[model samples]
Target: MTETAIAEHGLIGDLQTSALVGTDGSIDWYCCPRFDSPSVFGALLDEHRGGRFRVCPTGTAYTTRQMYYPDSAVLITRFHAEQGVGEVVDFMPPAGEIATGRHRLVRMLRCVRGRMSFGIEVAPRFDYGRRAHTTDVTESGAVFSAGQLALTLHTVREPEDERLARVRVEDGDMRAGLDLVAGQVRGMILESGADGPPREVRVADFQRLFDETVRYWRSWLARCTYLGRWRQVVARSAITLKLMTYAPTGGLVAAPTMALPEQVGGERNWDYRYTWVRDASFSVYALLALGFSGEAERFGVWLGDRIRERAGGAGGPLNIMYRVDGSTDLKEEILDHWSGYRGSRPVRLGNGAAAQLQLDIYGEALDSVFVGDRAGLEIPYRGWLAIREVLDWLAERWDQPEEGIWETRGGRRPFTYGRLMSWVALDRGIRLAMAHGRPAPLERWTRERDAIYEQVMRQGWNEDRQAFVQHYHTEVLDAALLRMPTVGFVAPRDPRWLSTLDAMDAELVTDSLVYRYNPEASPDGLRGQEGTFSLCTFAYISALARAGRLEHARQVFEKMLTYANHVGLYSEEIALTGEQIGNFPQAFTHLSLIDAALTLDDALDGPTGPATGR
Candidate 1:
């Protein structure tokens, strides 16, 4: 079988974990129980060894089209054949405020018109396809068991006379053949670790689950206050971000899948299933802007707990990233058993960069708290103290650097973006303290904040390059610095920032798609090149809009939208040929898309000139 394009997938989740369903009617990637758990179906990364659950027309020439239900995460894939048209509805029942051991994937099929014949295939590979599993088939369903992990597939077909032999396991995998006329419905449920025998699924039961799932998503989206030009696209981006979040701890993973390479057949693949402070912190304002204050509030609480945990220990202020449960240790490892996506080898898990000291996180963490406060979420006094201690520690250590925001293995330098965010940390901290009448070392924070600003302006800027460079000594421009205006580090219309933007356009922008930095110009320890970053492109659009280039920003934003997948989903990066090249459905990219839309809407609605920076 040919490999599926990374962009040709839609996401569906229960707010705890998500699965990627391809346009060809296959659940190729899914992690059971939790977002970071080992995959039960991993065909997205490896076609042969990694298993898959697929439902499609059999022994016929069919054209496939996939789309999400309006305003919901329910995915529908339609197959048009000479005989008839068949549709498959895929979703996971919403698990609201409750965590369960059992996770179910419900796939319902219907012959919308004429007569259609469809086939079902189920293959389960446990422990990343390293463990072998035994399949057992019964009258009503089939079970694939490997150690403690077991997946049961239950099916029901109409006419009430279809024999069990039609839906039995064949050659170690569940195989089903169904023939249906117009208005006939067939249902299948694949569930993880149930207590008793698989229940007999009925059409009515499938309808109830589908309705409830739709209701859960539509109700959640009803809270959005954005009545803007890009309402539908913005809502889709918001839903994608929400799907990437782990609901239990309020921590959002960068993406659900691991080791989907930025550069195919390169060593750049790293696990993005862990939560990064930088990504989540940048997401707060976007969440709040869409009236999702509850998500922002939960993230603030989760970040506060991490702050308290770090402050109580002898370790530094914070790790760059953590597991969804707020655990600090994420030891990176490679799974050598299964081949990577398109031969992108050394599929990695557990990011090693978690232990690196990226100083910008303090600024991002404090900014998240500030944004949450603005959204009417309050922090406890102890949480405030924890934040205060982080600022105090930062005041002393901001000048030093370990690793930059990109988590480049190429040693650390005094990154200008890192310093810019440090200024943001103290700046926001001082404002929050005075605004709330909270106890903080305001005088010292003020001095440190001003000092850092002066230091960055003096050393970080390069007169020759006519821009704020990537690091203190290099003349390379970084797309990450595009946030300088959005974060209030520099005025949007400041001549210096304008010069920086122009410089970036010359070096980093390729027809409005932005690369993080040119690795050849400023070598980060990595060996291969990467695609243009989606998050950075959105940031570029936001910066352009805030700078009062409304028409140009609008053009860029619309062009970037065309780059999004068929379902309005974005991955971490886009290859030169416009293929999505990194982890699919990245939270950072979607959140930045929301921020860009909000910024552009505000710009288009407001006065013509750039506003003064704070």
Candidate 2:
């Protein structure tokens, strides 16, 4: 509830689940074995009842800085005091492919300079902080016991008298005085003894693990094919997105942590830990364009598998979002007991909107699916069947109104963008069938696509604004509609698209930051204001680049890149004051940035050289 929302950190899960680390070096939020499972450290929602594992500096006059390693998921946080500076390196190795529940979070602490004191606090609140637990420390490590949860901490530093003395004292030097000039690696060990599948950690085992993690990340970075102007910035954002991915299912989440509100003191916070079908499609382009097709291909297979499981004869399609493991059981609830980030009350876990009738996802689905299978990747016949079944379902209901892209609670209007994407889904479906000689109802799909296109062109246009409107009647321009060119709904050079771009520039483009839509002009059923939608801001650059407005696009793209954090990470939205609002390290923002940069590069090189796909 402070000015800065402290204690809100994210965990790097292998896909089964994830953890959230607070600035206090505490794992304040973690749901084991799955992203949407009940919390282990629900302190993010209930500080008193939630479980947390923490390591803190004992000194009072301490300052901290957090950054990820260049082009890697390894996040290193540095703590500096008058005496010395210590760094905690947090990462999950992505090599050798371990099982889901067998995942590990490596927390390495070492003094960077001078001498410093450190303290360790282990509090494990299991089952959303509901179960009682106990703690024990052996010569090997320290273990915490809860109802069905077992957490063990391992390190090279032994339990010395001075180390235990740090518990009561506010400030003092640690037992190990790190020599800054000549670095030393002392062995520390932790063991898990409480229950479950027991595992032991020996200090000697850390060397191989550390080497594997660094090697894994470097190997992954070697796949990047971008040789463009913003290669460094683009690659950093790509690494950030990869870090946010859940490896087990290949289902990349929208973001890492939740309840970080769009407005610091407002109630616009939402949970983003789960995977959305919409995000998968955008990630297809982002991941593929960066020369990382293996992960993208795997994601396509994962999504197809989900469809095979859930595409039951296709009357009404699947839910909008699901657990990282593909479970559709997210039940949203507000945590009234805990005040929210920056006093933004009603801290919530889970998402109710997952069950909302967002008809727009059908379009977002095909956006990624079409591209994923376009360039030599084979989509199964069942996958093709699932795609057709959904489109057929859309043909009958394309005229209906439902929740639009913004997930607005103010009720759905005839959102122009939603209608536009429906057109995309049908169009792409037809194109895919024609390209591969697959069976399809081309007449029906083309009829529906053109029908929707005609209706959108005729009624969605606002004559007064000289641009396409948000819905049928209103003149409010939506930043999402700026993506019309990229989605293939309209050609970039089309006059209508140009006019809409100009209209957005005149209206939504406030210093190159794009608001999702004017909140005042259209109420989204929440109070307070939010920053410019970061996704839309990047989409602006993409739109410009696609239209051959390279000079302007480059300038806008560079400026947007500057808004990224110290380590070149982005979130869903950006506040007016340049703070990253919404979820941290959002996939949507990164994907759009990749899209824009790729387009700019293609523009300069004319597609004959290194870059093959546009």
Top candidate by TM-score: 1
lDDT of 1 by residue, 285-341 (tens): 888888988898888888888898888455687888888888866888888877889
lDDT of 2 by residue, 56-125 (tens): 5775578777776655666677777888777667666552334344446677767767765666655566
Residue clash pairs of candidate 1: none
Position 452, candidate 1: lDDT: 91
Q: What TM-score, computed on C-alpha atoms, does each candidate reach? A: 0.98, 0.89
What do the candidate models score in CA lDDT, each in turn? 0.87, 0.70
**Weakest lDDT window of 10 consecutive positions for candidate 1:** 156-165
Deviation in Å, model 2, residue 400 alpha carbon: 1.0
**What residue runs in model 1 are displaced by over 4 Å at the alpha carbon?**
158-171, 608-614
Task: Give the root-mean-square deviation of each candidate in angstroms.
Answer: 1.5, 4.0
Q: Which candidate is the best by lDDT?
A: 1
